[model samples]
Target: MSRHGRVLVAMSGGVDSSVAAGLLHEAGYDVVGVTMKTWDYETSLGGSGVSRATSGCCSLDDMNDARAVAVRLGASHTVVDIRAEFGDWVIDRFQADYLAGRTPNPCVLCNTHIKWAALLKRADALGCEHIATGHYARVREHGGRHVVSRGLDAAKDQSYVLWGVAQDHLARTLFPLGGLEKTEIRRLAAEMGFDHVADKKDSYEICFVPNDDYRGFLARRAPAVADLAGGPFVHSETGEVVGRHDGYPFYTVGQRKLGIALGEPAYVVRIEPETNTVVVGPRSALAERTLTASGVVWGKWAGIDGEARLGGRIRHRDPGAPAVVRQLGDDALEAVFETPRTAVAPGQAAVFYDGDDVVAGGWIDRPARAQPEASPEFVALPTL
Candidate 1:
């Protein structure tokens, strides 16, 4: 690999990104570190007068930490203000999804629409040919096309959230820690005297919601969501009135704890925002065999002319299931799992994989019919 070109490193003040910048600099590349100011901590946190240290990424403390690391590596560092874009793309979409009775994956949206998109533009403006980040994923070139594959560390693989990244952008994106495990990355940080963030706790909550109470955050940010009238919880099959729910947005599909006293266990089978109703049933009712998705993004192997067998995952932590995937149109696809799976929720992404490589992915549009009368004819779309 040539090391003479300039590369922009998206630093998050964490050990992962900090080590990424250091590794690139050691490789003889001219590295420039940039941290995105995604939001104002105080304002986003409801101006609770809390310290920035407790807040998540893009806080003042994080910026300072990133700057200190850049100084240690003798690299230039700058902060890019992306608060408005972040709000418009990620935060607003999050609230809207809940209001529409669908669980949302904000991380995937942020990676595709906000973080990488912003970094790529800035990298071009700074005369950098490539942009590097701390994402635990790998990009490989095969047969003249770039493909995104799972990172070496399966436990830390982030390729799921990155399926939305376009093929062209993957060509110039870099994941410095893709080949290394989490433990190795920490050890390298420690050996390089970056002890400050070497052991920092990994942030799992949404950055804008500091307390991680998304329900409370939505109530405050979008009050209309809270004012939705309480509705009845009905049984999916029997259509019997079981109990009442606080609101439709408060519950999610397959949630067992419906807060109502029932003789036997019950699970949320479906959420109907139109009727302001919550449907609950026995755990067996949650099993689903088919799901339809929209906003599909194909990976390296594009232009599927027929049904293709691939692995599908509905949630981030789910062990993928075997399924037959077929493109329905330009932006839609249908996946029929070989066996029934549970907790398949709408608005979550359905990512398809061929072995370790991400083949294609899309947003779950609706609960598909268990068995379509006939499979839709496949149509070949433009290759990415």
Candidate 2:
């Protein structure tokens, strides 16, 4: 047997995965390329929004693209049907979050449940020792334990959405293309005569919803959203009625383009699903000092000792900001910033970091009742 383990590369029918599969093959690993037919984009009726539940995997074009690359790379390719699994684990949860008026990250959910979860199963069935993907992230084993790290290129690093991945999964995962940058990957692919992938533009918008109209996509996928429409939009500071919107869930915090123009430039300050109100405000009100997080995964908080200070990044693109993190209870953490950070949104997640090591982190709680920063010393969460 070769030193390289049998690797199962999860081909998403894209240039990234195509290069990853080829690299693994060149490294002398017995490789199998697997493209999951997670959802049928054709049946969903052409790029409609509601990317989570309605239809998925972009379209037949994506699947065919993956198949062509796998054959060219001299690897056995298989399409594993996972429609039912995606619906249960991914789609249903996506619709559920939107209806509840939270801006859920479906790709994070897919990485958590479907890609790593489902593909890992196929790897076991094929007796493959590891599974690989085109994700721009890397894993390294240090001191007898596996650790996750950013890819070679900062622009392509996808470590944020992968926080929930298990240490064992990292140990058994291969990221062949991670050591290279995007330009290098494309250049290498073209050199190998992979025609379509050479000029392929990476898809940044929601894949299944090609049109990118999420509200209409939701209405078409789940009519429940449309039923909860025609609510009042309010000014955040004054709580004065500003305009009417179809739904609060349709908008995300920190978004400025979609708002109805007021006399001054106003940002989305808050979203109240129960009251069906979307609050807008001037930019100043958007700054926040402390954000509450729950669902703490104690296992992933490796480097932290007791109380530790760290930087936190709520969104993917953020450079992260300095914050003092303290455990409130067995499962809750409080993050207070040295200075307020702007455009922090509630319904999204706030992932914390202690340097490069992941200290405990979780979902961002809705804005808490404001007490003066000096009004009182903060208290730990009351234990049950």
Candidate 3:
């Protein structure tokens, strides 16, 4: 029997995951590497004449690379087909969110709903005690709860995207690269004789979207979007139709390049899908002090009793700002920032943090148009 029991590691044919599996195997754990086939590159080309070389993840080459790594370590590897699940949940939601004029983070949704959930099911079937990944975040038991915290590498910290991992899944999950930096992982991969994956480039684009062109992907997925094109870009402050955009779905909140010159700088402040209107305004108009979020997933605590001051992130790249969060209902809450956060995009994940540990997170539903006055006391904020 292995010293640490059987562990199922998600190998994505990347340096991080490969190194993670290597480390686990070297530590005397019965490691099983699995590469999930989430999408097919040929059909995902969207008739854009894009080649398979431009594809990011879940490719045939990736699967073969993962198998090679497993063979090198004398471990077992399996490729599971998850294209149907991914399409029904992640891809469908991606297309639907664009049609609804909301910028959806497909990676976040995949991780929360499909990726971990699927991995857990596969692990159970394989008699594995735990499932591991290459994500740069730490999970530990804290205060009788499984808490996720930021990785040591701030530049590569992925805790923002991992807030939706439920407490139960987190208990049986592991992040081997959480304590190590990217450079260390690369170096370790080289030291372990996996030269092919030691310097593999990280794939940033969405798996199914070729060349990071989400606008084109949406256009191809939903042909009806063509009719929504040529919509009016109304000014947020003056309520005047300043320009016209190809489509509201193609634009996201805080997008600056409108392809039309307005004599001054302008950004998308809001998108009204009901009217097929894209609201544009000066940069100042993009600042939002408060936002309402639904589908709350509590992490550190079951629920927030009252108001708790925490750092709230509106998007993945956001550094987060000081905010006081208050639970409004069973699965809804409002966040009042100490200072205004720019481009509070609806349909994006709003993750809250207490120090480095994730407190809870939810999908942003609405952001208040008026910037409420910032005060030292949280009770002074107005109701939604």
**Of the candidates shown, which would achieve the greatest TM-score relative to the real structure?**
3
lDDT of 2 by residue, 97-187 (tens): 7666566666766776677878788899998999998988777776665666667788988777776676777778887876789999999
User: What 10-residue stretch in candidate 1 is worst by lDDT?
Assistant: 375-384
Tell me the deviation in Å of residue 169 in model 1: 0.9
Candidate 1 residue lDDT tens string, 268-298: 8878877788888888888989999888988
- In candidate 2, list every pair of residues with a backbone clash: none
Between 1 and 3, whose TM-score is larger?
3
- For candidate 2, the TM-score is 0.88
Clashing residue pairs found in predicted model 1:
none
Q: Regarding TM-score, does 2 or 3 come out ahead?
A: 3
lDDT (Cα, tens digit) per residue for candidate 3, span 40-132: 665689586777755777667777888999999999999988887888778888887777778788888888888998899999999999999
All candidates: TM-score: 0.93, 0.88, 0.95
Whole-model lDDT values for every prediction: 0.83, 0.71, 0.86
- When summed lDDT is taken over every stretch of 10 residues in candidate 3, the lowest stretch is 375-384
Instruction: List runs of model 2 lying over 4 Å from the truth.
Output: 46-57, 298-300, 368-384
